[model samples]
Target: MVLLLRQRGRLTADTLARELEVSTRTVLRDIEALSSAGVPVYAERGRHGGFALLPGFQTELTGLNHEEALAVLTAGSRRGERVFGLGSALASAVRKVVDALPEGHRATASDAAQRLLIEPETDLLSRRPVTEEVPDTTMIEVRRAVLAGHRLRIHYAATGQPPQWRTVDPIGLVTVRDRGYLLARRSGEDRTYRLSRMLAAEELPEPAQRPNQVDLDQVWRERCAQFLSSDHIAVLVRVHPARREDLLSTAVAVRAEEPDADGWLRLEVTYQDLWHAEWALWQLGTSAEALTPQSLRTSLHHRATAVATRYGHQPESRHLLPS
Candidate 1:
């Protein structure tokens, strides 16, 4: 399962044998085993295709207790909120797990889970950790809209935006970490709405056609990849011995090198965009420096000045003398 997931494209009998450290005949037998176990294992006798699991073949979690079920749903919910593709799958799996929970503990556990208050770890740079619990009815409604290809008229609030009513064609429900999001199309744009921020949702009377313009999963993957790709402003930072963990925790797709004699570690990470990069540098306090992209240093210095001015003060005059 790990190999199938980690590897992309096609696989040959010999390739699978080498990867699994078994004979070619053994690889064929294992493929048969997967097939018999209802895995969509198929082989195409061509250069482009070989042994493969059918696309969208995933094990459903339908056998777990209330707490255990909640864990699975919550895990997927958080990740889906970040990457839109996994929302529908997570919702379906969560539903199955919820349905399978023992009757006596189901309702009580579900209610308790909904009321649970979670605090997001401040160490990461991903989307705000979804720690707030949304109502169960919202999840049900979102799922119904997604599966039935219905439009939803919802009142939603974005992080820095005012709340407003919008008509969205529900594509999938993404739950990242502690929050669920509705991935939908507005106008022609793909928009993600936090489930907790959705004040109200109702199925619209005017059922619209599901657009054939873009694949939701593909769009989600592209967005994530684009967001995490290394920035042009390659940065290196010396962490305060005390706050090294805090800095390391915020690096999403960065390479961190061993600390030098000074109690500071060097890291290689990209800024998603200028705004994101500036925000990250602020979080590092005096521990970070731009190893490249000289402009970032100037920008950070300017930002510091602006922020300090806000308090009727000037920034400290200790700019890292141009290295």
Candidate 2:
């Protein structure tokens, strides 16, 4: 019973019955046993109140050292996807566990939480809400496999391929720019698979081993730094504040800086990957101007020329812009 309380701040009779390997009737009997034996368990008759500890009941967790308390609190707060109900319940349960910990651990716990703040620079959901429904069960299963460090047998369909079943060891789950990805190690190869294309996944019993062959974070950082230091050209944009908000909200770039109170924002960005930036700029339309890097201006002009050629000559006497 005490262990159950520590694991979950509150347990209902049905939960206690399941945990104790007894029926609900037996659980009630046991409660009576504890009560008769001078324990202060109180069972309320109303809908909201079940069995609750008497008002002044005390426990050892209330005396934790700073580090210990912070560890508990930080773990609870780290459940960031609690945009739904489960996250809230999980967070609430974690808080109770932290609250129960001894006071000596509070400072250490707080410091750890501060040091480990994992704020994502970009969130896929922040751009807008998604109406497409993904099965909650599928998300749960994927999370379970990730937590266990196990390989999963998945049926996946890529854009140009038929659905096929493959075994993969998931390394990370990323939600970037309105898309969720499962970063996984492909079986029999050095490459990784993305989860969004997964059709189905079944967890295998065997655990996937982490490779000592690569320092993962260092590798990613090196790649990014290499791009920043390389011979790649930079592009500049002059943006109005209203447009700046849209750019900041949608674009992934190295730097965004506001130049003055004139509501003009200057951006210094590199296009390491070219597939998406042009489409993004087109979406921004007239609000954005390519300010510098004359090569880009030439390219844009050529593109505009090609577009006008495709549409034939404009009406000779009609002005396009409004008077």
Candidate 3:
């Protein structure tokens, strides 16, 4: 209401009530409360009369200390703004936070914040993270439904399948590693939907069925563990000591690790499927070797032979230029 009054200038009780979806009496009572709190709110009596703020009135929000202010500013600098569909709102909030800080601390906080960076474009290997494209309108509706406790119907495009519409009881929205997910229940069964795969969405009039209190962190962890454990295949490999960390990072889990006779580390790791195992080992090149599961070794050998056949040729016989 304060923002509305400041933006529109002199809104009547009826107008304010209509905008806020409340009664005029409630609006009058709120105005009185604002006055008692020294908010500079006043009402005009004559025909062009309504509530207005005193001229040059600005609310001073002085709740944050210097370090707190810098943390808030740094958080705003991160792409977390893009995750929750609050980019513009976050920008406005940062401006208000800076404006509310004391003059002496403001410059120091702002300058210090500039020295920190979050989620840079490229990682150590110059590999950029792939960002999924989500429509703004779709995200807006999804967030609205989640906040308002309303059920949602979404046109979802799952991997290896065509798009389909589904009605879900939205539990909450979670952002992980630059990707957004809608954790919900469909037919009393827990389900997770990727926000990037949401082709379109609509908020239903009916309220969603969800627990009164939700621990999203716990829920996400459980779901991740379940996903990793389902339909998985484990492999044993001997990795060079220097490349052990690389192998561990790519594998879902390191089941066992021990030193072999040649001083290399023999590790057992789990992959989601055969293709996943093949692809991860291929990226390691000669730094690692597959020990067990002769199928994996054969697959890699066949792939290597294919590559050799394609590239192993005389320079005169090979036409490198595109025709």
Candidate 4:
């Protein structure tokens, strides 16, 4: 409430109540408590009157030592800053934290934070992290709505689909593997949307009817469980021992595995879908062979045949360039 008053200069009780999602009575009592606790809080009662903090009134976060301050800086430096669209606010907070630390410890904390690196452009294996791009305008409104417990409307376009407008009661926001998602409810059913897919967003004035408390991690786990159990394709394969890891990494589940007389590892696996199973098995090349599901074998054969025929001297299809 103090921060709100500091930002806006003055805010009416009704406005404060709406912004803080509490009753005006609670707001008034909290203001009283603040005043009793030696804060420079004051209220004006009349038309066009409201609560306002004294000019230049501010508060510092107390009791955080060097180590804790450094931890905050390092975490703020992470992909989360960009993922959650809190980069500017985090920068401001870090500045205040540095100002609060003792002058002697401030420089040390800053230098140490700079030395700790995470998710560098190129990892040790030369693999680069994939960054999903989300427009700042869209990300900011979505983040605001979720944090403020307000309804959100988005113009979103999912892969291979037309853009459509949707209104959801946003419950939480999540970032995983450098991608952002909004967890919400649409017409009473749970929905998850990729932040990068949001073309535009608007925060509605109406409050969201979400549960007061939520275990976001549990919700995410349940969603994952449902996805993994849906439309799975079971298959059997024979894989060379040397290339076993390549085969297992892409599979959703390993149903069974046994050694064959030919010194190969015969394994039964499940994949997310037929396409997933075929693509994963195809990636193994000659090192692994699909043993069941004739359809998979046929699809692989057709793909290989197309590749071979394309390279084999098919006459007219090849373009003849002028020498």
lDDT, each prediction: 0.63, 0.60, 0.82, 0.81
The sequence of per-residue lDDT tens digits that candidate 3 reaches over residues 145-191 is: 88789999999999999999999999987776677889999999989
Candidate 3 residues lying further than 4 Å off, grouped into runs, are 1-78, 236-270, 291-294, 301-323
TM-score of each: 0.44, 0.52, 0.65, 0.60
Instruction: Give per-residue lDDT, candidate 2, residue 69.
Output: 41
Among these predictions, the greatest TM-score belongs to 3
Quote model 3's TM-score.
0.65
Kindly list the per-residue Cα lDDT of model 4 for residues 110-143, writing each as its tens digit.
7897898767898656767777999888887997
Which residue pairs come into collision in candidate 4? none
lDDT (Cα, tens digit) per residue for candidate 1, span 1-323:
32342224368888777655579998888888878988777878866767776665555444545433434554534443323333334444455655556656767777887897545555455545436655555655665677678888887877799989888887765544445667777897767777888777778666645665557567666655655553544466656666665665555556456776766666666555666677777897886765556677788889889978798866578867787
TM-score of 4: 0.60
TM-score, candidate 1, is 0.44
Which rank order by TM-score, best down to worst? 3, 4, 2, 1
Better of 3 and 4 by TM-score: 3
Clashes of 3: 0
Candidate 1, 317: how far from true, in Å? 22
Cα displacement (Å) at residue 265, model 2: 3.6
**Number of the top candidate by lDDT?**
3
